[model samples]
Target: MNAPRKLWLWHVPLILLSAIMLLPLWWMVVAAFDPMHALIGGHLTLWPVTWNLKNFVAAWRSQPFGRYYVNSIATTIGIVTLQILTSSLAAYALAFLTFRGKRIIWGMTLLAMMIPVQAIFIPDYLILSQLNWINTYQALILPFAASAFGIFWLHQAFRNVPRALVEAMMMDGASPLTILWQLILPNTRPAVITLAVLNTVFHYGYLFWPLLVTNTAAYRVLPLGLSYFVAQQSGFMQWNLMMAAVLMTVLPMMVLFALAQRYLRAGVMHYGIRG
Candidate 1:
């Protein structure tokens, strides 16, 4: 009926939704430190009754998580870096350059985005197998280096850049690469950082492709490692240990988001306003 009441009505729903979403994360933190017998006995609480660090130690020692962490970090960084580079270049060309069949190319990119990766898995696997790239970093990283969504996102951001600025740079006899590196990239900093953050977050948790590609624990990434850890718990589920592994697997991405939140927010704002 009143403004404050209406505001409360909206805020109440959102607050409830937020709590619902965060419940699992809270459960994870609680379970990660709580003793296994307490967890199994339904003694779970919002706070840890008895804090134990053994779960973390056991989870870490149980598997080659150290190697898994290294592989995940390397593959994620490689994929994000290459995706940003290739996507930005393609976006710039599509947004700024005038060429024959440009529309067709753009259309194709959109079409590619429409097709899910699962649809092309067989072909991709065969190709990688032919190249003898399975069970290697190349298998993990190369297939995902080019992102259709990244190209589309950056294309929208690139379009927001003024044509006059590009023309002025060209008038100064700057090469296309120079113009892209200096003018376009600097102006699109927020978008670039946001894309990087998003890519990092997505690839950090990527499980399906890595599972399909690699067989051995040598090249196993975090997600696969977590799954393997779960599988090793044959008779009884080690809830506390599993939760510890999850927290460990998730911590880096959480830190990454915290560090990049500013840029990510700015980028979202920029895209929203520009659109």
Candidate 2:
């Protein structure tokens, strides 16, 4: 085959796959803006016949979504910030510092990563309950502040740093914290940003933990708010309104990924090269 022809053939499959993945999202956009009468009349189409703002307005007014947005944003930011700090520090220590039982500690972290969150939920819940943290922001943010996966990911990135640079820093009497913030983190900008973006996306969609810890609207996040909205439509499904809410819930992460796509690509490349 000619080179151009081969390249086109290779790209065809990827293009198809991309379209397949985006089909649902495109449908969501269509459904979100389609008029409720059209939707209820079973007049579904790939493109909206009638586009209006009614769905968005109705979805927003149907529930306390404003509060949900605030709670979700706050908790997600808090979790991602704390995860970066704790993970980077733990990773730096594991990768650079020579300490007793370093292997054991690293092994434990790996084990923690392997264990499912469900397996430890009882213990985590009990600890929070004893501390009287239920139905509070602390319960939502504290349990996930440190992530074993984050530690492992940053540890790998940290190991990619030049050993000579670290040794020279140490010789100049640079403290561990200084080395971490000044050298290691700066060098791993792509990885750190990638982790932050991924963590934010994951925690923003997190429903199970928030559901278990919070019972009131004051602490309810977006995912739970969506659930409540769905449940309220017990017999009849408000597909248009529901999809509008889903779109709003996911729009931020979509914008984030679009903006940081380059960094995400670079981070993935670094991981493959380093590993």
Candidate 3:
């Protein structure tokens, strides 16, 4: 085959694969507007002859999606804020502080990462229940405030800070706390933002633990509220509304990731470079 023809042939399969991957999302956009057709129905509607905004409106009206949205935002933001604070402080200690049993403390922190989140669910539940936090926002945010992954990530980033820079700060009569807050933290902006964005994306879709912990719709996040569409009634199975709900739930984090793609890449690169 000629060069152009060979190139076309190679591109053909890629084009087909792209279409295959996008088919569901395309159908979702179509389905979100077509209220008459259910998502799993035999007759697939390639395009809606009539585009109506009712499905989106109805999905919100059917349940308090707005409240669920607010809850999700609050939980995600709260969790990220606390994680950044705690993880940065802890990572600073692990990276710079010299103290008794420091290695053992760091070892325990690493060990925490090895323990699967699911395994701790029962204990976490018991603790939250004892605190009467099962149906509260604290139940959603407090437990995840200190993330092992965030600590480890920041630890690596903090290591990249030159020792001379810290010493310079110290020689200038700056305290260790001042060095950490003023020098190290500012230099680690990319790593911090990357972890915050990653954590928000992760916790946004955290369904199992949230569902287990929060029973009331008042404190329910988007994932739990989206599931309500499945559990409530046969009519709610209409794919259009469900897809609309899914898009509504997913779009924020998707946009966030898209915007911060470079920072995330830089964080990973810095980790490798320092290692």
Candidate 4:
């Protein structure tokens, strides 16, 4: 078959656009390893003048990165786990169950998605205070355990399951719970993984709520720890150290995306199945 001539033109602009989007990320990687002099001089080198692991080592030692790392991992996992459970359950019920006010409830849930997080911050802080959960993991993890986007995305994926299959399960004496676990979940792996990736990354950078809720250093996550690093230092920013700190903070998510990029892309498609 002859190639479509216009296809090449379509991709030419897309390639250029992709390069433009990637330039900042490329700069960040280069800047992270540049020598202090090169960094100060603002030279854009494709490769570092001298390669050293000192930035990473210094970043790790400059603060309690070990503890912060552990806390961040734990908190992110906790939130993602709860989100999967709650969002899946809510999505299953919304997608398959017939009940009074189902549409109304679904509408409300979708409406909740439109509300800004900033609007709820005061109420969330007040509730945490009333519960005396300040400086506790509960304060950090509980409120965000269920994401509107996750529920909405999973609901869409669940909607793609054939209605005939659900009817067959019902005729076979399988309850909704059984159908959900055996029928829906097995087919929605991509959507689940995509939501998990998004939820994990979202939690990774979660800062404002943590800063307001956590009063002590021991509970600090990477974002808060980086803030503390900035505050503890004096004079003009130590460009090298700050870049090193930024690299340390961003490394885990980068490693995860690198390892799971294929799965993440598949999941994104699944999540968008209905859309």
Among all candidates shown, the one with the greatest TM-score = 2
Q: If candidate 1 were superposed on the true structure by all CA atoms, what would the RMSD be?
A: 2.4
Better of 1 and 3 by TM-score: 1
Please give the CA lDDT of all the candidate structures.
0.90, 0.91, 0.85, 0.84
lDDT of 1 at 190: 95
Residue 168 lDDT in candidate 2: 100
Q: Give the TM-score of candidate 2.
A: 0.92
Model 1 scores a TM of 0.92
Please identify which of the two predictions, 2 or 3, would achieve the higher lDDT against the true structure.
2
Superposed model 3: Cα runs more than 4 Å off: 1-10, 39-41, 272-275
Cα shift from native, residue 207, model 2 (Å): 1.0
Query: What's the ranking of the predictions by TM-score, best on top?
Result: 2, 1, 3, 4
| Candidate 4: tens digits of C-alpha lDDT, residues 1-275 | 98886777888889999999988677666656766633355555666667676776776788998889888998999999999999999999999888999989899888989897778899899989999999888988999888787789989889889989998999999988899999999988778888888778889998887899997888999999999988877876665666677888898999988977898888866555553
Single out the weakest 10-residue window by summed lDDT for candidate 3.
266-275
- lDDT per residue as tens, model 2, 1-275: 64664676878899999999999999899889987543456555788778898999999999999999999999999999999999999999999999999999999999889987778888999999999999999999999999999999999999989999999999999999999989999999999998998789889999999988999999999999999999999877878899999999988889999999999899877774543
Worst 10 residues of 2 by lDDT: 35-44
- Go through the candidates in order and give the clash count of each: 0, 0, 2, 0
- In candidate 2, position 130 carries an lDDT of 95
